[model samples]
Target chain A: MTTEPPPDAHAAFSAVALTAIDDVYRFARSLTRDEVDAEDVVQETYLRAFRSWHTFETGTDVRRWLFTIARNVFLRSREKGKREVTLDDDGAEIVDAALAREAWSRGGLDTILERADLGPAISTALAELPEPYRAVVVLVDLEDQSYESTAEVLEVPIGTVRSRLFRGRKLLQEKLMQHAIDSGLIPQPTAPVRSTE
Target chain B: MNHGHGSDDRTGAAAMDCAGAMDRLFDFLDGELGPETEVRIRQHLEKCGHCFDEAGFERRFLAAVQAARAAEVCPATLRARVRDALRHAGWTEAAGS
Candidate 1:
């Protein structure tokens, strides 16, 4: 026998949680990196959120709440170890920015960014990124969540979010550069470059 | 890391140079820094064309990534599936009733 949800609960769930289906689905897809697995995660997320609708405080950020639940569901489904990555990222930001500048100047990445239809390529690059960095980038850059909010969702400290976010951007930049070169969007380097520095 | 930008100690935006400004470019672009720091970086950018250009490239890159992902939405099938699951779990909202 099922205890039916009350009228208001149904209305509230529909209004708040259901409205964020797209955003939550995108976040789930970023985490799982597979459409089928992502759909499963989103389904479970909505069901769990609906079941616990009473616990959700009204007038808060619905998207953040749903994202928290979705992330947890994906993690549990994978049942992998903790995804925390230790960082010695003291100068990584400067180094990454400089290298990206080098790539941009060398490859005319400005043109690639402006004129190219990059949705598929960006998705592929993002899918290939490691989990920790991908999560931060998706939450902060794609989902437009702030660092503080992202930290809360990922259950990491604020510093971790910043470091991973920078590192993720760096990796994606490098990958996109290579993608451009491979796709003939940019010319191959005249000299076989050895070091990124 | 070090772009040879002396100590991290600086008085204000007046003392901030290209290296210091460039180092904090991501934080500035992300709007993650405090007001004073943000103002300092902005002030430096306003005066320094080189750092400003570098910041522009990075900013555009981030915007491109955001634009790429913005088009994706929850698929219709997943939406229907969730609606059905909700109904099964006592949601009581009939479809097209």
Candidate 2:
């Protein structure tokens, strides 16, 4: 006769997997950028995860595994084609820290937090980022995943994760700076100085 | 990766310049830098008011993003749906055996 797992085995699986439910859903929403699609992806991720539970290593990171699966499912769907924007390198140079500090002290960061309403502005900015950059930011900055773990989740080299994260944060900063100016908190300064030294 | 710092000795030299410090700002903040490199950057920030403010702004910006993300809670209905699906799958597996 075939042996069966004890009834509590399923319960144990649910307990551990359910702890990551919110994380998975939030990641799904960030990737899909649409409520319906995000919900569908989360559902599909859970089902696939359940079916493949036997393959999961006992001590490994379950969260990253779920994210990998979720991202794969999203990519397989037709909506993937619509979300492939790449980072624009023409404006990706690092800003001079001294000038950037001057601008920020002159109401840049404060204005972004106060007038633009931090939560919504950040959410919108994150959503507007190109997909590759957005994924890195979401996985690293927002989710607090390590660069190594993020590399694994995105299936890219650690160097790519670092570069994407740097560029992504830079882009987000630019957006917030613009928001600060548009909110009348600060006047736009001359273009950021390109340091040749 | 060497920014032309000729000697391995970082101390007693002039503090890191703006470019050098800024290049490692994120890595420094993320705790990814080696202890010696981190000390060099920290020493630079101590002397460079401008770089300090720049680092401060980025730190706060990252904190704000984390706060915003923490505020997001998963919907109850979705949690329930996932729970039910797992339950059904479990039953199905048991029956098939």
Candidate 3:
């Protein structure tokens, strides 16, 4: 059964939702990490968005509303069981800091960032990250969304967004660090020579 | 994490130490910290070389991540597919146009 939307409601959806297609598609691609699946997710997302057009509150962010719908669509399309990752925010931050310190000591990550082209490496690495972390990184960093907006989109706490973002960036950095070493952009780690007394 | 020397005033001259600065580095980079804490961290960074370098690396790394997917947009075929799906579900360009 189809319920026709009022003309004004349809116009509003067109103005806001249609304009956000690119952003929504980019977000879906990040979630799916596969072009075909991303297309499917986007198609379904728009369909749902149009049907629920009246439910979207005016003067609020259209992209955020659309993103929430898109995320739900992606989740539904995934396996039957939704994977829940329990994050010990404090512990995770501690580990992330430790790993970052180690990476810095091994061979300056700043040097790698300056010397190497991270575009290809980053895309591959982002694709490889776990969905929980990848989604946060994509929304917050790639899409330039705020923490509050991303939290709402992912249906997680702001703290969760912070932790996931930190973890995601660290994981991606680890991958890029390896790529830099493999590509000879940075020298292999070497032990310091002891001073002879 | 050794947060830093216990100082009640975050924006004062007696700002946090390297440990404190490093602890809040990610939040600082992400603009998630409060203004007072931000000032304190900024002051600490000005005086602390190690923390400053770490923050710089993190900042650049984030910028790189943002750059990686910057060029990607919705493909034309996907756009058409979505539009078609919307039309099939009773959306009309006339209403929107």
Candidate 4:
């Protein structure tokens, strides 16, 4: 005999979908960078997910599945010929920890914390990041998703997720540093400091 | 391979250097490292001031980004609208039940 899904399957799907709605919207907003566009993407994602609800595996992660659907929707609706960020060798460079330490010690962290009202600056900087890097950062950093989960959402390898996240974070740090210097919270370095060794 | 460094009295392993510790900082912070590697990094952080400061800075930076994202809340109207639309589309209730 053929078996059918539970009668409350729709209710269960609705509950889980609603729970992830805010997160779904946030991800869309980060990608679309426009309120209207983000909302439209979110609505489309939910509608699509609802129609294909039966295809979702029961025990798997619902949020990740939703994110995958949302990402696909965003890509399809995005304008054609949009400039895609090329992940090059330079973009995969490991962050310079020593340089970062030196910068931090040179009143960098102090200046950043002092300019604690950097919410708008941070938001704008995130929105301006290259799409690949931005998506990884939003999923991994903003939403606290694991690198593995983010990879599944973006349909890329875990290595790609790791590299994109590292580069994205470095870019954001640089942007925040620039904002601090522009706001007079930190002074620009005249010449690079030579390591004393 | 061991880095030929002195072992920490508490953790009984050679402390990781700035480069090694920094390389694993994100993984350590994200709880993705193995227990032994995590202990090594933790021991290094406890003994080294510079690496400690760097890790602290990264943690704060992540917190700042999270705070910025948290500031943007999904409007109640949008939530209600999505819910209403789902119900209207008969996605909330089984069809012809």
Candidate 5:
């Protein structure tokens, strides 16, 4: 016969996952640039994750799945429509095309990335990579996920993922190289004459 | 795989689109390329200045991105905020009450 276990004084919750919590916040931050929005997203995501922890399968990549859910919540909030349309991104079918027009007309990305230090320039360049490209870059380049896994999370085909990643990287490289030129990281073209020698 | 510097014919040789090049580049950088394609790209680069620059630039750029990722640790205050939120959400026992 087994003795009835007395009520444990320990907290019912698992340990306060400091790192995991920070990751949720950061993932939220990456998804939404606004700090307040990010905080709200993080809070909601954690509440959901906590409530469903028992259902989360063992040996699965918890962080990746968590990111998918958080991204969904963020998108749902965006799809709910803003009270007043901000001058930034609104992904509705027609609105987004208009937004694209405005973004393109501003030549928002035409300025060559000035190579100051890798930190600031790279950050700015990364930010400049346009909507979905930016997300793919953050997930694959920054977050270090495999292509298939990233596609699964982003809900795009593997080909789409590859295309975006390649496009983003090519653009980013050009920006950084331009920065390098301006910042004197690389020597300027020696005399404008094309060297055929 | 042709390393003929003066050759203008890329038709019969292995040429890939931007998408394919990109996929191969990432996999190659990650050391996932087969020996054949790897050698082909290497020989291609030796003759094709543009592709050579593209490959070189991406290789260096990925390293920089890796370094950037290394430094992206979240703020300590961010963590504390999460903890506080968890407490408020009644996610912890003592804190839940």
Candidate 6:
């Protein structure tokens, strides 16, 4: 399940290197959001961690190190494929366009929100989030890791995690608010929540 | 739809309307509430469409968070690439640079 320091021999750690699979895959899923991609990330992380298992030198936080590798894989993927992805923030606009198309589409972005079509908007805003902040958010909000665990995964100070999360939420709020207004889902302040869709 | 506050609660009257409620509403929907407080918030949401819709926004926001920039798992051929890289472990580098 987990790797233990060696006699180079411990049954528990030796049996299967899958102790952290669930955590690994879940965070990986949050990172890549595709089950198959996540499976690969986990597979890659495990193999790497296993190989480096000896050099682990007795005191390192393997999970964070493994996550660093996983994060790298993510970064590499983004860099390699950035040209292909949409990466735009007009997600709310897209939602509006989709809803408008459906003559039977009664609910607006709010309904979209219910259905999570707002994934695009959230994704757009997430793209706007800088690297470690974005990573921290993925670990915290989506994967629900504890604060210390996130700091470990990002290999940052605990304080950095707090600041990034705070700033990240502010940025998201501003972005989402702007989107809500522009799409006519939430009315201008005068009408606010009651505006007709 | 109705934006006006009802006459029952003291805080309801002193504060802003549905718009103002929407501002605090995201926190409510994010499930940040304490147990007792969450109950009250949910009760409010259960009755109000506007606040309920705001909750919907939080759900969609979560979905976006989940899907955002997430890896698109490559097809089986791509999987084989990863598998090949994985075979090498410590020296593993994805194929094709």
Kindly report which residue stretches of model 6 are placed more than 4 angstroms away from their true locations once superposed.
Answer: A1-47, A53-65, A71-112, A176-197, B1-78, B88-97
Residues A1-197, candidate 5, lDDT per residue (tens digit)? 12221223114223433335545665666668667888777766766666555555656767786777777778777884343223222323323333334323222222322222576567656655555666777777777776777789878886677766765665565455445556655555443311110
| Stretches of model 1 off by over 4 angstroms after superposition | A1-5, A80-107, A191-197, B1-14, B94-97
DockQ of each: 0.40, 0.30, 0.44, 0.32, 0.22, 0.13
What range of 10 consecutive residues in model 1 chain A has the weakest lDDT sum? A81-90
What fraction of the native interface does candidate 5 get right in terms of contacts?
A: 0.32
| Each model's chain A TM-score | 0.81, 0.74, 0.75, 0.74, 0.63, 0.47
Instruction: Give lDDT tens digits, candidate 2, residues B1-97.
Output: 2223223344545567899899879877876666667788899899999999878878888887887785666898887777677666662323212
Write the residue-wise lDDT of candidate 3 on A1-197 in tens digits: 35667766777778888888888887887788788888998899888888888788889888889999998888788652264334455436544654645654434556656534667777776776665777898888887788888988888887788778877777667666666666676775573212110
Give stretches of model 3 more than 4 Å off: A79-101, A104-108, A112-117, A182-197, B1-14, B94-97
For candidate 6, write residues B1-97 as lDDT tens digits. Answer: 1112222233432423465455445344444334444455666677788777656755665555555434422345544554455444323232342
Two-way TM-score contest, 3 vs 6, winner: 3
Preferred candidate (DockQ higher): 1 or 3: 3
Per DockQ, the best of the predicted structures is 3
Clashing pairs in 4: none
State TM-scores per candidate: 0.83, 0.77, 0.80, 0.77, 0.64, 0.44
TM-score of candidate 2 chain A against the true chain A: 0.74
> Residue A64 deviation, candidate 2, in Å?
1.3
Collision pairs in model 2 = none
* TM-score attained by model 4: 0.77
- lDDT per residue (tens digit) for residues A95-125 in model 4: 3532454464445744575345877778777
Which pairs, if any, clash in model 3?
none
Cα error, residue A61 of model 4, in Å, equals: 2.9
What is the per-residue lDDT of model 1 for residues A118-137, given as tens digits with 9 covering 90 to 100?
Answer: 77777777776666788889
Question: What C-alpha lDDT values do all the predictions have?
Answer: 0.77, 0.71, 0.74, 0.72, 0.57, 0.51
Give the distance in Å from residue B38's predicted Cα in candidate 6 to where it truly belongs. 11
RMSD of 3: 6.4
What TM-score does candidate 6 get on C-alpha atoms? Answer: 0.44
Q: What's the C-alpha lDDT at position B73 in model 5?
A: 59
